[model samples]
Target: MTRAKLFSGILISICFGLFLSACSNGESESKDTKKEEVRTATDAMGEVTIPANAERILAPNMEDSLLALGITPPAQWAIGTTVHNYLQPQLKDVPTIEWDLPLEQTINAKPDIIIFGSPGSIQNGKYEEYKKIAPTYVFKEEESADWRKQLQVMGEIAGKEKEAKAVLEDYDAKTKEQAAELKTAIGDETAAILWVIGKQYYLFENSRFAANVLYTDLGVTQPEMIKALPKAEAAWNPISLEALSDLDADHIFLASLPNEPGLASLKASSVWKGLPAVKAGKIYEMEDPSNWTSNGPIANNITMDQIVSVITKK
Candidate 1:
């Protein structure tokens, strides 16, 4: 063959090979794009049909639960500015609303659904107004302690019930394991959980609040004094600082409000320093104020870790 003809033949062969490779690559890319378009069920507050690619969402209080279920809403209906620190990274950009109050900003967001952590304030009239704008769901106050149930309800609403259930089961198993370990480490040491609010304090009893996890879930015994306090229908009972000495627990899990004067007052009080738990250096200060009262999924996990760490560390 002539040299020019031989060169032309080699060039054509190379071109043909390149064309086939490009076609193969294009086919694979098309398949991958189609697979990526596939949608799955998302469970939020209740059973609602959500597109696998739901763009706009509004989470008011249960940010932790939503995060646990891998649902990151584009917007958050926040009660306060500081709450942003508590939200998962996916929700940090969401705007904040007036704490526990309905603001026009939230309504303007035009979200598909609004999930509330606390609905009592909204129930009086605000919730109805919100319903006119979008589907709104309030967490069941009765199931406050059952975070798994809360997640399940959220998952069902978001159309991700199965995922929520699995997440709940996993969290429950971890909690149970940690609780068992905490029980062994702490042994029979009695503990009291308290929140320093303003100049007063509130003690949590086993049946009253989520603090029951310390007793019911973690197998920690309640201090006799806290157990003897007058039981009310509420989760916590308010007591005077003068009564601090009466809460004779082996250890005290005290949560103070950040930048609040309550801690200063408690420290200044002679009776507080004389308490057996205080003198023995058994007070575990909780840095996260939300964990002291929040019943959300992340808060529950935070509480469990705090309990285990405090008990086991000692």
Candidate 2:
């Protein structure tokens, strides 16, 4: 009878151990489910529920805005054969997908949230499909082009509003400090920016892109040629080569798209060679094509650093 009792006790102890093991596994699963609980985000398309503290993020087209917000996505969107070279060091090994991401590709990446520069394009034919895969957010039409507003909305969605505001404030302080230094370095010297795309020559107007960096941040004087034109409604617009002569600023900032042979052709034009900035060796060739045309707080910081390096070295 005693031997029988000992065997029964051993069997009961084994069952208890198994029960405890099962309960521990159940608790772990409960914690994981809690971590993945859905949260709400409102965008142009209305409210969408996404995984809280999204472990993986994918922005097919607006990687610039995300990077500017200090959020590095799992992958960046690629346009044709081009990627953002200016952000190379930060995104060195990050993978890329087509601008209009394929459903299968996006699914395989397993993004908890997806963002787009413009997801409302019917022609893209993937907006709804993307929504099916993950909680997608699209910037409003008016705010899409404005980087400041983009950052604000992005911060709201990512729970980084305070960090975003701090970034902007820091940028403002840096700009003010740089402007003062630049004033002492080169007082009242006017500057102009020229971008060449294919056969077209474009001059940046007041209050955007490089102009925002040059005139607003660095406090560089705008050439009368740019001032005479109306405020910039678009980022860039076509200007005749004859118009290039009107940009008689003391310093000229020049840049062109990658693999663009137009800079050579523009220089070959007697009109370009005869410009005052060129003749006086005051023309500066901007190295990074990415930030020179786009506007974002981080891009603006890079713009300031590049220009200051050149001017201070001189």
Candidate 3:
């Protein structure tokens, strides 16, 4: 009878062990499910649920903020064959999808979420089609316009709000330090940013894109011509040669492609040649215009460094 009792006790102990193992496995699965659960966020498209821990994100044109937050998108934004060259250093291996986000390509990318730069980026009636592939979040005009706000929104969507705050804090600190240095180096000298593409001459207004870094952040004085111009309605706001001739900047950062016809025209024109900045030989020609034309901490930092280098010759 004692021997029989011993055998029964051993069997009971084995069953208990099996039960605990099953319970542990169940708990692990529950934890994993919680990790992958969806949460709602209010965007330009209203409240939408997105994965709490998205493994693959696709944000077109908004790659600057995503990259600043240390997230490499599965697909980069492109216009035809053109991609943002400045971001290629980090996104060299990522595939390109059209700016409009094609249906077949969206399905193939298999993104956990799609963050459009602006509501306008959602072309045609394709919002529903994209929703079928993944949760789509569209940034409002205000959120999309300011890099800092865009970065924070990206963090909230990706469950990294703390990280976004840290990035902004660091950026603010850098801007303060660099702005002080620029003030000391250049004093109150005014500057203007001119981007030449083909035959167009687009001037950067006070708050446009990276101009905020120049006029607002770094405390550089805006030229009378730039100040007098109306707020930019488009990304590339062009100025007539007649208006450009009135530019009164001490320094001009001229961005253009090598051998661009616009540069030739500006050089040949007596009016352009007579500008104060050109006559003083203060025009700094930039072959690569990516950083100046775009916004975000990464792009703006590169821009600040270039500005400091050129102005200070350091």
Question: What lDDT does each candidate get?
Answer: 0.70, 0.79, 0.88
Clashes of each: 15, 0, 0
Model 3 lDDT per residue over 216-310, tens place? 88989997888888887765557877778888999999878777888898888998899898899898887888888899888898888888889
- Between prediction 2 and prediction 3, which has the larger lDDT? 3
Tell me the TM-score of model 1.
0.74
Candidate 1 lDDT (Cα, 0 to 1): 0.70
Which regions of candidate 2 fall more than 4 Å away from where they truly are?
A: 1-36, 119-125, 231-236, 257-259
TM-score of each candidate structure, all chains considered together: 0.74, 0.82, 0.93
**lDDT (Cα, tens digit) per residue for candidate 2, span 164-280:** 798788888898889988898889989888888787887888776778889977879988898998878844578988767777888888877655677877888888888888899
lDDT of 1 by residue, 1-314 (tens): 99999999999999999999999999999998777543433322444333333445576656667787888765664555557454545666666665554556767676777666554546455766776766565666654336667777677666678888888787779878987797677788898888887776878866544476677767788888867766546444578888777888998888876666888888889988998999999898886656657666666677888888876884
In Å, residue 280's CA in model 3 sits off its true spot by: 1.3
Off by over 4 Å in 3: 3-7, 10-14, 17-32
